[model samples]
Target: MTSLWQARSHLFNDRTAGDYHRRLAEGLRRVRDRISRVDRPFTGITPTQLAARIGRVDLDRPLGGAAAALDELEELYLRDAVYFHHPRYLAHLNCPVAIPALLGELLLSSINSSLDTWDQSAGATFIERRLIAWTAARIGFGRGADGVFTSGGTQSNLQALLLAREEAAHVSEPRVLTGAAGHFSVQKAAKLLGLGPESVVVVETGGDRRMRTDALAAELERYGGAVIAVVATAGTTDFGTIDPLPEIADQCALSGVRLHVDAAYGCGLLVSPTRRHLLDGIERADSVTVDYHKSFFQPVSCSALITRKGGDLRHSAFHADYLNPARVAAHLPDQVNKSIQTTRRFDALKLWLTLRIMGADAVGLLFDEVVERASQTWELLADDPRFEVAARSALSTVVFRFLPDEPELADQANRYARKALSASGAAVIAGTRVDGREFLKFTLLNPETTIEDVADVLDLIAEHAARYAALILEEPHVPA
Candidate 1:
């Protein structure tokens, strides 16, 4: 009789190919079945329940075969997974990935290419460089621009800030300035770089929630030479607001401050047919971060950190003997030379394949459609008396709160409604605290998501808020 290890062998040998194909086919079928069966984005289970269910699996002994393990995964994991592809998943920056990118992911994983050095990656090195070059041109960075693929928006921002930090090493006290609405990562990056939290000065924003140029100028003047980089947000998180980039760029130029635009959320507009002009002055920045995963409809971990000057990438370079050996590093294009990561995934293939098959204009059109949908959804909310909608969206998010009859209960009502709606699993959305008040947010990333979907979610929100408000009114309150 054959032993268990012999019967179920690994991938190093010949027989594994047929077994791999069979298992992968089964997995694909299960994915299709899950997509068809699950109409909701979530399974309405609490975090504690999910943890307990998954914790029951014993790791001591093997399940004995691939089919059994896959079956177990389907029951414990896939059934409750948050499905971004679900039309009702209007929660966050998550997007429905393109089919071409998925296909590229499949190929890249099977090949298992590591993109650190030239010999290791070979054609993959050039492929990534090509994508970076193409993206730099899209931003109109011109001839001298250079960039490297990163894990996501967070990592890309960190790398951009790292470059900015190195360039300012000559200054005695280096600092960074950004708008109040900028991503939290800005502060985190500053701290990690040994600049201390105080080094990040938060400039105020206007009523529309965009960085006030006057305020930013004042801060720059106050800091003077201490401010090494002026960070401008192309797309803010809560309100989807964009700063006046052209104006900010002018200020940076006058002061000789290094400019870095965080366009992770709005990078999709780079290809937009009508909205491309919104990103004006982006090319003027010293550095920029673009997250393809967020707005390019690629899978997760697809982002790039680009610089206006190719030579600026040297700030992040350090030679490794085992990896990018000195002998060959001079001649070939080793990706690790300019990147913060080693053993990076070949994620650039996803966008390359996407562009080859679907074309850039097609992806841009999808983004345009969703942004247009957001405008229509905003009108639906603005016209309704039940909600107090925030300012018109600059991208694809609408932030608003449910208004009950009692003014004091508005915050409580909105928070309660979001929780109740999530538990029902009819639809899923995100929540945020704007100006110390709770509000519900609709982040429309799917072009297929319609205004009718927004209306349905709004109706559910109102119903839940009304029920919660009634319960609050019926309760007896004791004075503190």
Candidate 2:
């Protein structure tokens, strides 16, 4: 018994105390080396090669023993992982979080607290509650408002549609209506909530990306009670457009239908006093989805679903014998009852620490600044001779392309060029089809990125454009 106790103590003790400093120091040095090496304005690993390096080996040994097959972890996977924290990374909705949040992650995993209940989680539950309540207030949810942090926009939307699904069961199949600007996750949520792809109908909107109230009314009238709920986009991914949520809210109120706002992207601006007008009707939403990773500058895996009523989550409550013992005992709070997940990470801790170190308003200023930079870039791209800017600025992402005048060759050339461009080790931006034409996209989520960085990206795209033009010229001329 004494030997067993000693063994267990050693297992949980500082297993790497002697080497922790060394490993961290080496990693920091390597990071410094990488940062000094970059001269371009964008970077991310190629998807195909990154996929090839991904290797997982489950440590099924059961008693704190680590993987026996991870010798390649550092050399193959860790070092080559996509460097989003790089100053040049302006390619996606990903953000470089505050270092405090990263430190919070270390403390959280060490404590390993589960925020499912006020009992098991103790202080952890309060931490989550404080963050949720604070986030709700930012969205103008009144004193009694509440919410839960989820995995991502997809899961938050799943929970949003799930609430509508359980409440409006009387509505027939093919029962959901959403703006064309809404994220694809709403449709996925519909399918998971018992309505398939056929059930989710897209209501057309104008170029401004606001849902047409007339179109929504016509569809609702034609379909009658077949519609269970209506979804509006707070920030659309395609063109960084904000669909008119206030109009959709009014329509839902008139129609007596549920309103779910996929505010995953735009919700971050709630803290930004200057940019908060973009999500004018957020408080009116029956449910709202926000991603902390996008705007609040938290690590990935930090998203949330906020509802008008805290009790609305009963729609998904379930009693699992082993998973949710609190449900069986009837004396403890079960987070699984509120969310579609169990064994959830203490993601709330990072958000809490961030709010403490930097007030929500400061984060709001960051949002406003990024949007202002995007506007600055929008004008810059318009004046540049080598590129074209498409769409009005809604949030941070600016869609543009190379060789604006060569529209006839734009489509075919972009498809082939970006494919080769990413394979090389220069700048990396995304490609999007705007009004059926391909344009390079620099999605500005990083507050560290600058308008000058946008100029660097344009230079890279122009260089690639010359090469792409030569490659196209080499192809045999074909008669249309």
Candidate 3:
């Protein structure tokens, strides 16, 4: 077995430029042929059908359940199964990863490094910390800052909020003050931190989709209980709106509140010379969250929770004698201490390889390209009078709706339009209700996405809207 493994390693290491070029050609052919026309998700076939095609992947009969159950895995069930790489796929915040990052993933998986301990990871631990340090330095934390990579933005946000919870003494269910337009994960993180539903104070926002600092100040003054932290959205989930971080930072500083910035959307801009200005007040934040997957274009699961305070991860730090012995390099970081998951994958490897190859500016430029695509989308929509934009903030998500004659049916129309499109297997788009008005969202996180593609989707939207409107009119027997 050892000889076989060593031989396999040798073959893998022998992956040359020519081999990669050949593989890329195969990938391009598969993607172009299978995904070009597919706008909507493809889930018609079951896992059993897929297995049949692969000729029976035997379940419970092989190593680590490797051959286990391919009988029902639905590729379309998961967001990733859908073709995010398709030019027309303007549905989610997911980005098609850099080719090099995928290669890095392959390398790391083959090595199978467990990040929980230094004995398992060794050089990998330092690489992860180095990447964290690089990210931390950009946030102005310098020597005082430290961080840990997480599975994605959700985990990163959760970790930052937990740090705040610890600061709040875990007493009386600490309250979290956040913008009304904050990411869904903020409330989830609050709940996970034991803040509960009642503890979350969804503060009103200013014109920029940021929580009004004045409103937060008022909430702080009136609230009797200890405020755990003020969570600001550096990049909102839906509208891509950036909260007023500087102003929020001032409030948190004055009120002695821990400020956690969820910059998962906008963090990539920190590397952009042109757009880094969006994160002005992030320096004042006690902790900040960033997702390398979204705009950084690393892969599916590269996220980090960074802090200006070195010991902020205290709450997450574990004390298993078997895992963490104080005698073993008191400064050594065991991944188990800072992350929510144990037996975590070596996600940092791709990130390390990414930053190493692309450099920070190249990575930042990738985000810059996406932002530019978003601007182009704005221009595309501006030309058409049939569509009404809900809002177009600085980040990638653009919310708009078709204007039907009956405003009353606007919500239903918006929801159904998206449903009909996805059901047809033609294209996939995102939808959300804004101020009771349902709207379709164009979330452009992919750098490969073009203005023409967005235009194509908008045209499809108009066509779908008209079709649905005609249906509403024709189905006279049913109440509108």
- Candidate of highest TM-score: 1
The true-structure Cα RMSD of candidate 3 reads 5.1
Across residues 1-480, which tens digit of lDDT does each residue of candidate 3 receive?
346754453343445546545554564565555555464554434457655654654544443321122213323223226677666667888887887788788778768888888988989888888888888889888697888888877888888887877777746757788889988888887777667788889899865666787888899887745788888888787788888778888878788888888888899888996999889989888898988888778777888889898787777887888988988748776777877777777888897778778887888887888888887787777777887885676878888888877666666667777876775656678988788668889888777777877877777777777777777888844322
Which has the higher lDDT value, candidate number 1 or candidate number 3?
1
lDDT of 2 by residue, 186-255 (tens): 8787777767768888998786666788999998898777777898888888677877778878888988
Residue pairs that clash (backbone atoms under 3 angstroms), model 3: 39-427, 40-426, 40-427
User: Highest lDDT, which number?
Assistant: 1
State how far residue 265 of model 2 sits from its true place (Å). 0.7
Displacement of the residue 262 alpha carbon in candidate 1, Å: 0.5
Range of the 10 consecutive residues with the lowest summed lDDT in candidate 3:
65-74
For each candidate in the order shown, give its overall lDDT on alpha carbons. Answer: 0.89, 0.75, 0.77
RMSD for all candidates, in order, please. Answer: 2.0, 4.2, 5.1
Angstrom error at residue 270, model 2: 1.1
Ranking by lDDT: 1, 3, 2
Pairs of residues clashing in candidate 1: none
Q: How many backbone clashes does candidate 3 have?
A: 3
